[model samples]
Target chain A: MLKTSLSKLTIFILTGFLMVFFIGMSIVFGYTNTSIQLAYEAFTQFNESNEHLIIRTVRLPRALIAAACGASLAITGVLMQTLTKNPLASPGILGINAGAGFAVVLSITIFHISSLQAFAWISFLGAGLAAICVYVISSAGTGGLTPMKITLAGSAISAMFSSLTQGILVTNEAGFEQVLFWLAGSVQGRKLELLAAVSPYLFIGWTAALMIAPRMNVLAMGDDVAVGLGLKLGRIKIFTGIIVILLAGSSVAAAGPIGFIGIIIPHIAKKIIGLDHRWLIPYSALLGASLLLAADIAARYIIMPREVPVGVMTALIGTPFFIYIARKGLSQS
Target chain B: MSKYYSFRILADKISFLIDKKAMIKIGFLALLTLLIFIISAGLGGMPINPLHVLQVFFGGGEDMERLVVMQFRLPRIMVSIFAGMALAVAGGILQGMVRNPLASPDIIGITAGAGAAVVAFLFLFSDHNHSLTVSIKWMPAAAFIGAAIVGFSVYFLSWRNGVTPVRLVLVGIGIAALMQACTTLLMVTGPIYRAAEANIWITGSVSGSSWEKVQILAPWTIILLIIAFLSTRTINVQELGDEVAIGLGSSVERQRFFLLLISTCLVGGAVAFAGGIGFVGLMAPHMARRLVGSSFDALLPTSAFIGAVLVMLADLIGRTAFGPLEVPAGVFTAAIGAPYFIYLLVKTK
Candidate 1:
């Protein structure tokens, strides 16, 4: 009874508590001195003042977008890892984020799509191409897609895309100012309506993720075991791959390619709830949302007056964690 | 008995080279590299006649031609060759020591660590440099100290009982990512002008390289390459695992220490001058192995030559590809080399 009582529900409740607390903190903490009272009043009052406007427009949307992108990327990571059966997999590491970013840049430069939705539509194409490139290139030759090959291929593709992106930026510093925050993976000062543009795809991706979570459990049990249990490996892989692109692309569109959340959150969630995807998925979502909110809040105070990009903050936190895991897992293998 | 002795002597000569075929391949690559070098030096956005390029090189051309070839192009070309040699030798030592193809300085966090340190110095000390020469000279030292610190820390971190290749590579990757973020954060968060300066360095350009920088880099390259060459036998022995190396009377730990030191210094010096130019370290050694085969003695020079050739070509492309608007040499190296690396991954087991 005691063991059962310490269930995933309790974990969910704890995560929820953390999320609400951080969201509240995110809303209240920023350059403009906004009290919790102003946060409540922003929802209640019909005031047209600058302070209330700042609270309603700036902090609120920034916090929400950060959380939304965090959740989207974390879920994407979980799905990618499940599909590939490689613990080291994630959108950032696998070139999906870079791909999405490249597409957004190319569209802005060449097509001059100057609105919110272009990020979503164009990046989706770029993200898909990048993923296919990594997958096809790694799967070639005799060894047939080992973890080592995938990692090497992903990094190489990522390097190429990132180099190209920098080339474009350097050639025309005109685009630099507009995309600086986006390139650095900040949610600050982004147009809030862009959130509305990307939300639908994220929602679809999330729903797809949940639907396949149970199937993912059997798939994790190696290919032969999954086949013995009557799972359609091909269909499952294709579905998971699509969800990964959607979620990863949307996050890149909405925010820049905020990394490590996707890679780290799934690991954190799994530790709390084990490998049961039904439990893991929600835990990952909650933790990711809360963590990014916390990171955003910290980003505000780190170098006061001017804030670092939340991406940098997350990288600082996530890098040590990654190193720890890499040290442990790779050494044992 | 005499016949048997002569046969053994003949076999010893064959084994000295490992393969005649590989030696011929090395010679072919060397010739190809010389041809490319001459072509690159002669032609650019401002074209010089190839015969006149030789004249300009030997101090006999017209004033404008001399200015373009000697004062500008020659130094840039020399830095590319030196930087490439340094990086390739460093990488060759690392890969040979680790027995893993993925163990380049770039992959293993050494370049990023050194780069981050250089950024930190610029952000902290640019105001106090007092002169341009002082500011320029301090960069390599700062970068060297940074690489040493990072290299030592990474070495110690991976040294739990003994270092394993996988653990080292993994930890290196994680640390490399972290250092890059630190670098970017420093660049992004600083004032715009400093940020631009840091950004150019981070991308690995040798633009505006002068005779002074070539002087600084050349000696380091020559000395380090020589040291690296002498350690080939030890590195080859170290590749056969610790127990086997011990059985062969090699002090595995001491040799490994020296090899790591040599690689770190070579890489540190190169990055200090070139601003973390990458893929040469990783790409050149792999190409050498396939082209010249892997007898460490022959392999060292072959890899160094390949690295020099690759970077010279890359720098040539970077300067000329878009005319006055230059792409950084590092960008060209990565853009071209990354695909080939993937192809290598496909080809290799």
Candidate 2:
């Protein structure tokens, strides 16, 4: 019991360290590499100069967007994997990204909606619908919603939405250039207002997720065992699913379908802190935020003066981790 | 659905029988491929009769008709059919060796790996070298090498004690996603000027086929198909699961490695020519299995036929659906194949 407390303390300290590190990083790396003093000054003092303005407006907001979206996606990914009992399950695999992307395209093409708040709602609706479709389809036949079925159904659903998105984008040439970076997913130059708009959903979702993490431990003990342990399986499943969509939907709305973080962060957290959701969930959130902010920093510097998309950097980093987990865990299973 | 056509004598001692039914299925599939070829070839610009398409091939039509049939439609259709057959056969071998219906070249990251290499080739050479024609010449070889590397990585990555189909599949999906990300990175970072072109390539089209590509693709596809068909006996053994295959005294590891080699080659060659068309790999084997049962010998040819038919039909729909604005066959096939796959998923035990 004492050892457990020590481990928890270690995790909290590590997470705190990463949070500070990312905050420092968000201020330092950009067009003009600022002195740490200037970075601090930009935060405290109001300045209209281009460098301070960049630090103040661009870098700060971009960092928060990255952190918020990354944290939301990573948590959703954990819920997805746990709920499905599949190591591979993530927002991308479960059609949330594609669903939200399709909604964005639909809003642009049909509804002609340009606001972030509207996209957030549309994205959530699309995500919820896609999740429902995937669940219903996978749950239809015998041995309801097996990992294999969910995987297949998710693939199909993702394909369906992406195709629809491609169709709309191809025909509606006006939306193409506008959506280019959005589709690729970046935290650069985005308005803090967008992040502000979606923060409530994320906050509620995170709180709900944390509240249920202990119960998720019960649910993770397999269906028969969980039922035997006096857990209501249906309520847990429905609640778990709602939180996943809430988290995933907002992230996609804010960032336009960032990949790999959702899948990768939980694995990193698991490697560090083991599988208890109580610790795993928060550890994953902090780690995911740090990773995304770091990737965004690298994304800015990699091409120098020009930036690669944040999505690209995450994919590059997360894939090896993904491959590693697949090797170690999947092979054993 | 099947007719007997041949007898085979194995080892001159215990006769290993070759069912005639498999050959008949092959023959029917061949007929379907040829018929689809004729019909689809006659489709674009103005819809000509299949007879006229044949006549145009024989130099019996107007010059415009001949050009449309032979130069424009025929080569692209031939590429589509060849690519489809190669992918389907690759999928067949993977499904058989891996003992999972989910196993496909695309799922295993081969196509995406190949795609990433080609995109790199495009971005790198086109920018610094300004020698796209030279790089295009080596694109197929580069894609082949990239796919082989990815295939080996996935195979070895999944190998622990011995590989299980589930593990291999899981690893394949992870690697596939990563490789896809690399392709996206190239498109996003390299230059925005080429974004439109890069977009089309990512979607996996069979457009812009020349007679030269068709010529290279044809022999390569046929050779791979023959090799795949000859492995029918080994595929048959592997299908009964690993324990049974081991019980039957075959070196399951060696056989699986060789099958992976064949699938990598087929996918590498096809994707080199046809970009990144997906779902044909997953859908064809399932369709063939429905028609001809689980036997690889029969399933091979039937799948090849169905794959060729599916892609050709997708191409026709893609080219015609938007008229002046032709969608890639990959898009149409995805639209069709994803639904069928969902249906198959729901149907599976």
Candidate 3:
């Protein structure tokens, strides 16, 4: 058992290192006419030239947004899985993304609210409302807040919100381009002020998640056992719900509804580090950040001057990983 | 022995009594389905009285009125019925095969696949400046191919020793995300007209659905519905668990594969005809199961009926609810079905 654990740890470390290496490589490669020498110089030392503007103003902010969004989503997934005791539970699954998307849609179209700060607040409110709605709906039946119930409720609500978003876009054809861009999710061309607005919430959410990691592990043994050990199930539920809202909401604010990273990364982390949240949370966060950053970099270079959405790149890379983890999980279970 | 013939009659009578409860449930579902259909037809922008609608249906209306009824309302109503039936039947088979309440065409990435393919086609062909008429001909084929790719990928990814429901669901979720990302990417980079067209499709409206769509969709729908009906026996045994199914001499793998194929076809066809219409698949099966128990024979038909009625009602509401400003049936279904679904989820626990 000790030997197996050591091997797993080694694998985890290796994967982490590999991800970082790939991200570095991605940042160096782009569709621009600039030579590799210029790319390196622009990235390493700031200059007032066009190369510096492209690197700092465009690529760097994009990379940061990717990392932040991926990390936030992955952490939210970890919290959700632990809280609901369901592997399928993720921010996207629970309608948090849809809620945020809906709020953004409403703000952009109906109200014409354009400020990033306002967008962030609206997204947060939407996430919170969606979570509460799911909780209330799932809890209404005899099973209380069973994992399956929550999953179903979330799926239903997400589907509904998604359709509503689509409805608004369809009716108001003028906003189609803007809404589509946001919906696809990207970190490109965003101002530093937008990142600053969302950073505090992301930090707070990350802190809260880490603080509750131990409790989550205890809760994993089943609710009755945790309660027997004197843990407050109600308080824990509320706390985790708040963490989900914070992480998912802020991520949406930063980068609109990037998908699959949350669902896939946590599962990958779990396979490497066992079921302990202490290791799982950090590993997943780092892994998610690295994956998103790498994917965003690929998006920039893959099509050259015209970039693909970061969300698409992540999905293309992450789906295969998700399948592997899922197969393994199923076999083990 | 001749005197003992009465005992056989008595035994038959006892068995019939046991079956009566199930028969009654089936009858109630059928009645409710009819009620929903009538109520749905009575609603819409024209606000035709239920009596007038019936009269028009029975060929009692004037020429202009008849034209309006046939051209405007009839196609929408028919599309709703077809789409709803397709979704519900697909969902029922999936839920039974997967033994998970949440397993539906949308959940398994088929709709996403269709959505992605249509969006791509819309963008790729738009630069040609082709007539709107020409584009519609090619869109369904693109959507169908996309759905097939996604369906196969999910199946392949989930396959190991056997296809466990959980693994299938996870892989479906993964592929669905990829498909959604692809749709989003296409929308962002594509031309303005293409993007708008894709958005409308994603919202899942039956608007502008000419007789051509109906013609293309009808045959596939009927064929798949028949196939789903034929597989009911196998599905029933499969749901009992794989070990038991194998012990009972059922080809568990083959049965599941065929069922999944049929479901994907139905879903792909429906999505190609309409867009990513929501809720009918998820809602119909749950409601059907409640009324008809877990028997596949009863559950399949009941689900199809309920699905048809739900979509029809949603479409009617979509057409009439805001007067001239029509809502897509897909939107109303989600807005209405989602909260109720949530309530059901909560209450079931």
Candidate 4:
């Protein structure tokens, strides 16, 4: 771990540079190849060419969305793991993604709402509701929410939401076709307006995550220690919960509930930067952005002309790491 | 001795001891399963009389009644009942083997593996005409292969000194997510019509049940169930924990593997026939434990009955409740099972 401030700063700066490079890679590489020169011209020169239009309209928003979603999801993972005190906690694992996906499908099916603005809010509502349900269920039992209880509760709730989504889709075949890709999760072919819709919420999530980093460091010492340190445990928890919903919800809204980035990035960030949230949070953001951009880039090439969802790519990468951690045992910090 | 009844045959070479109360409870549950079977068979689009359904079962009903009861509804109902029983038994075996209340085939990735296999089967076998190039008979084998591959991998991967329950579950979860990703990738890349078909299968439904599927799944499930029941003594000892089982001269690791194999086979059969019917494996065994206590001999059968009832009821509700649109049985199971699971989580000490 990078202990000295100078080394940490240097690594952080390097990661940020890496993020920029990945974003550029994401933009330049796809089924339709656009050179860096063309990408540059698309940004700088006023050309109404097809490649320019594709670069400007299609690839730019997708890269931006992937980066934003990845960073937001990773931060959400860090907050959730800390909040639940569970190494396995993440929006995807906790039924938040299924919830958001269900809500999106429900809105499309029942209300027939196809507008971009409606999609983002519905996703937030669903994610918040799921997070609340998992919390309430896990906390209600005798032991007051151990990591195991929360994990089980989250998975159970995910099963419920996903089955409900299936029920709706089974009944409405048209809706099945409509949201199938979305449910698998992708940053492909997404409109900039969708990102525009959720960007403010994502921005707030990032800022608040950074602001709350110091308090989280104390909270990591255990609830009793934080309480003895004069922290308002209830208020901080509620604040943390809201930030998680904001970050996770908007990311899901932007990228359709991409999985594993949140779980993978925070752990990787901690390994490189150590456990101090002050450095850890920003470092995770950069690393997460780079990871998703890289995954998105890979998603394009894995099947060639037809793209596999980046969600699948992340799972392919994340499962091995997940298994390693699991085999390493959960007791380690 | 008064609480148990002992039976002997062949000069005590073969003997059985059964708890009288557990027997009574099992009998009552068996009756309840029958009642549910009749009700589910009687309440579809073209409703049949319960008496006529019973009569049709014994070959004494009008041709229309026989067609509706035997041809249309019987296979579907049988599929659900047996699928439920297999899943419940599998869940019971897993919970006992792991000594964790939350352990079940679905939670561990057996079902997900089966789901991925089924989708892959469809994706690979379909020719340009979109019809399966291979016989549909082979699909169940594919699902079984998938579940077995995952189940054994989870077991082998968790093996360091021996397979600890924690590592098994953790590895299972990891593999389950991977299987889910693979399933989704296959579904998304396939044609929309095929995607819908695969979706229904993944969610788990008996909507496409036929006699041939019943023939395959029924025998497979029953054999596994019997094997599971006979191994109850080992599980009961195994549940006492590794040290005690070892102390009792039980080969703990080997028996654990045997039991895991049984549950894996049971799950393989269940998912092969019913698709990925979600929460029955978790819910049924739990409810059975509540009904019959934790003794494996009584617990396994009770779980089977309860599971049969739950899925039969879920299937009934899925097809009948929505009117015109047939929903998959897996959805109703989750709708009920998830809340009950929350209640279990809350109510457990």
By TM-score, the best candidate is: 4
Off by over 4 Å in 1: A1-6, A140-145, B1-16, B128-134, B234-257, B347-349
| Tens digit per residue, CA lDDT, model 2, B261-285 | 8889899888888877888888899
Best by DockQ: 4
TM-score of chain A of 2: 0.95
Residue B314 lDDT in candidate 2: 87
User: How many pairs collide in each candidate, listed in order?
Assistant: 0, 3, 4, 0
Q: Rank the candidates by lDDT, best first.
A: 4, 2, 1, 3
Off by over 4 Å in 2: A39-44, A109-112, A133-174, B1-6, B10-29, B127-135
lDDT (0-100) at residue A102 of candidate 4? 87
Candidates in order have lDDT scores of 0.80, 0.81, 0.78, 0.88
Ranking by DockQ: 4, 3, 2, 1
Per-residue lDDT tens digits for candidate 2, residues A195-219, read 9999999999999999999988988
Candidate 2, residue A96: CA error in Å? 3.0
Better of 2 and 3 by TM-score: 2
> Candidate 1 lDDT, tens digit per residue, A260-285?
89779888888778888877887788
Tell me the tens digit of each residue's lDDT in model 3 across B1-349: 2211111245442111113455566677668766665556566655566676667789887676667676776776777778889999999988888777777888778899999999888877664563353546888898889888888888888899878776777778767777888888777776677777777777777776766788878888988898787677778888888889999998888888888899888888888877778878988999888876887777888888888888877877777777888777788778788778766765665
| Candidate 3 CAPRI category | medium
As for TM-score, the candidate ahead, 1 or 4, is 4
Model 3 interface DockQ: 0.58
